[model samples]
Target: DQQVKQNSPSLSVQEGRISILNCDYTNSMFDYFLWYKKYPAEGPTFLISISSIKDKNEDGRFTVFLNKSAKHLSLHIVPSQPGDSAVYFCAASAPHTGNQFYFGTGTSLTVIP
Candidate 1:
């Protein structure tokens, strides 16, 4: 069974709007959660992250919200830009898993001008 899943395959938004992407995980041991953005061929770049101890983390236009009780998380991009268009992935790592990360199926976000 997949530990992480992204229910939405894609989302589209106009520029300068908010883009929301959701993710869910089955593992409760996951202590660290992160969001990564990827281009067509390039590797995914880290976006935002939150620890199990924290409910939220934000960076610039990106924000990540974590709900430990629900085993769910979401990424919100404010003022989404065309350049923000990309595949967004949710990842989690457990303390016992070392550096191993479990990734969710990505959600493709399209930002229209």
Candidate 2:
């Protein structure tokens, strides 16, 4: 069974709009959550993260939200631009189990100009 999952395979949005990507996890032990954005032929880059202690974390145009009780999380991209188009992945890690990260499949975002 997959610990982390991204239900949406892809999303399309216009430039200057908001793009929302969702993720869910089955493991309750996960304490740290991170969002990564990846481009073709390159590795996924860290975007934002929220610990179980915090409900939300933001960095520039990206924001991550966590709901521990519901075992859910989501990423928000404000004023989405064409350059923001990429594959977004969600990852989770448990402190007690070392730094092993469980990652969601990924959500592809297409920002139309």
Candidate 3:
């Protein structure tokens, strides 16, 4: 079974709108959740993260909500901009995994100006 999955591979939204990306995990041991944004060939840049102890975390235009009980998490971007068009990956890691991170396939967001 896949440990992590993002059902929607892509999303399109007009500028200044809200863009939401969702992710689901099968591993119950995952305690650290993170969101990363990537452009074309570049490495993903960390956007926001929520620890297992917390249900939500936000940074400027980015917000991440974690539902541990449901093994689900979502990333919300408000007032999306054309520059925000990129692939977003949801990642999770267990403390015992020793710094290893597992990433979902990713959700590509296109913000039209």
Candidate 4:
């Protein structure tokens, strides 16, 4: 059973617009934090993140928000650019899982120039 799932498989946005990607999880105990993963050809790397204890976290044009009650996580990219086009995945690690992480299916975002 998949614990995490992306709301959309893909999304498109015009340049300079905001692109929002969302993830939902079935597990309520995943209260550590949420991380965005951008996988290259080889492996996934950290993109952005937000703490489970907080509602929002922003870094440059990237922002991540957590809705604890809804078990949802959203990643927002303002002024979406072609360079930002990628498949983004959400990951969550429970306190009991140690360093292990469960990842959701990716949401591919296309930023039109």
Q: Scored by CA lDDT, what does every candidate get?
A: 0.95, 0.95, 0.94, 0.85
TM-score to true structure, per model: 0.97, 0.97, 0.96, 0.92
Span of ten consecutive residues with least summed lDDT in model 2: 91-100
**Cα distance off (Å), candidate 4, residue 88:** 0.1
User: CA lDDT of 83 in candidate 1?
Assistant: 98
Clashes of 3: 0
At residue 4, give the lDDT of candidate 2: 98
**Over the stretch 1-113, how does candidate 3's per-residue lDDT look in tens digits?**
56889999999999999999999999899999889999998999989999999998889988899998899999999989999999999999997888789999999999999
Q: Candidate 3 — worst ten consecutive residues by lDDT sum?
A: 91-100
Please list all clashing residue pairs in model 1, or write none if there are none: none
lDDT at 7 for candidate 3?
95
RMSD each, Å: 0.8, 0.8, 0.9, 1.4
Off by over 4 Å in 2: none
Find the 10 residues in a row with the least total lDDT in model 4: 33-42
| Superposed model 3: Cα runs more than 4 Å off | none
Looking at model 3, residue 3 earns an lDDT score of 87
Tens digit per residue, CA lDDT, model 1, 1-113:
79999999999999999999999999999999999999998999988889999999999999999999999999999999999999999999998889899999999999999
